[model samples]
Target: MKKIVAMVILASVILTTAFAMTGCSDRVVLNVFNWGEYIDESLIDRFEDETGIKVNYKTYDTNETLLAKLEAGGVSYDVVFPSDYAISEMIKRDMLLPIDFGNIPNFIYIDGRFKNREYDPENKYSVPYFWGTIGILYNKNMVDDPVDSWSILWDEKYKGKILMKKDVRDAMGIALKLLGYSMNSTNDSELQEAKELLVSQKDLINGYYGDEIKDMIANGDAALGVTYSGDFMDLYWDESTDFSYIGYGVPREGTNLWFDAMVIPKVSKHKAEAEMFINFMLDPEIAFQNSNEVGYTSPNTEALRRIREESPEVFELPAYWPDDSIVELSEVYVDLGEYKTIYNQIWMEVRIE
Candidate 1:
């Protein structure tokens, strides 16, 4: 009887080992890195459940931060979300892998206007995710001035109540646009002038913030802030927020018309799984859910139509879907290449000052 029991225990151990090895070999894990608060978390769970592909997700605040991590070369991310200029930089460095459109059948849902953009002209390496403009979000009760141009940010009257983005490219772009220069200007003298403008406005700036800027302005912690169109719209449409007292405007001097997209990194181990996830995100119903939850303008044409149909009031707001005139005035950011170092130096000096 004792011998029989020992044999049974050995068989149990062998079966457990076999089961563990089988599970380990069959499981597929995809690592996704994206902007903070950019997606609906529920969709991630749903994707995992449907595909049986476990997702390891993480978030970063700035595109620069995302670029740094990708450059650092230690960690591996299967999928990443980066803005237009950043995508250009990555493609220049051969950091991205060309996507297989055959696997992404839902790519048909993306709006034609968003495709073939300058950053990825052929639409080979990236998939358009969200698009918007940078602008001022101000509290009407706190400031009586017209918030039509970038110059209003430097007004002395709102001195201690002003906010700027902590992001280098965005803040610098604002200064560049105000100087009547292109936001993508690579001219050293023009960049220097923009830098000086930021330095001059530094004293008036209450603080430099990131995603928290939306909440800060919403809570009336600051009178005015430079923020994304989508960030302002998110709060504007929220039932809990007082919409009557807040306003958002794309400055007349022009602003950054930015596009953030998804790409598979060359470092990706599960390229197929990454493509699957990208395709899943592009599904019309899933895209609508994400766009509605995050309050960003979806690049998915079907999703855009759904939003307009479901929330016609959103389209009524100029800031939500700017007219063609505003589109003509706005400029998309492009890779500055080696000139990025100068912008970085200028930003550091402005912050330290």
Candidate 2:
């Protein structure tokens, strides 16, 4: 993937010089770092065609991976999609550029519910992209028992057929929830308990994956798997496959309500273009396309209205637009600071064991 991205960047550089030499001096390239399969690829072409800006896209599977790349300072990215807790961590470290809402008039289209939230109380650093919960996606035909709780992941009957997320937060969060604790629990004892549970259940895990969990679950490779609610929605409603029988459920014990938002890194050299890209994304039509392709809930009010008007059935799916009861039980992750180290250590111990 790194090699592929490097080739794209090289080609962009060559093309930029070519365009400039040919009198197209205003052309620009926007470097976007986001989660794998998080965006609608068609939108990139549209953005470039409309704005004369090329997109050099790259992907990371987890927030931790994104943080590591940023901290390493090996790459320069104009825009990044980090979750709520991640955005908070970057802000504290002065790693993000405060967005100028002036340059982004389309910010008004974002739902008020997502604004001034805990991660960016002043709403100066990031803008909500997609938001959803974490849940278990089980194959209805593969599992005979009810799948309402996090404990289902540990059922020995499904040993070697349970897929789990490679993400530390999601994995640990599941164990924390199973033990009746906050997904963001910083208590040492509580964290240790979660760690122990994960380590003990390692044998049952078929693999720890990211977006691939969707295909794995859909193809019957795993009887059950953990994934973002939005990803499950995509697989459940996928028209190319027989996924209509799949089932997804939030644990009765509650789960993480994650929000992946767009932010400009301090190292970004294309702040104006980055903000332009963000503003373009906020356009109702663009937002609608993205939400439709990614199967995530859009935080754009106008986009939601358009979706409701066009495809009321898709808009009404609980997996796409969850009810208040589920929303009430979900908690967004917060910056754990030093506690984050503890979580990483515990996560490492589980993986190694």
Each candidate's lDDT (Cα)?
0.90, 0.88
The TM-score of predicted model 2 comes to 0.78
lDDT of 1 by residue, 108-176 (tens): 999887888879989999999999889999998898988888998899999989999999999999999
Residue-wise C-alpha lDDT for candidate 2, range 1-353, written one tens digit per residue: 99999999999999988887877654677899999998999999999989889899999988899999999997889999999988999999999999999999999999887898778989999999999888888888899898778999999999999999999999999999899888889898999899999998999889899889877888889999998788777776577777776888777788888899999999998999999999999999999998878878899999899888888886555567766676777678887878888899899989987
Off-target runs (Cα >4 Å) in candidate 1 are: 1-24, 72-74, 155-160, 192-216, 219-221, 237-244, 344-353
**Residue range with the least summed lDDT across 10 consecutive positions in model 2:** 314-323
List TM-scores for all candidates, in order. 0.81, 0.78
TM-score: model 1 vs. ground truth: 0.81
lDDT of 2 at 85: 88
Report how far off residue 251 is in candidate 2 (Å). Answer: 2.0
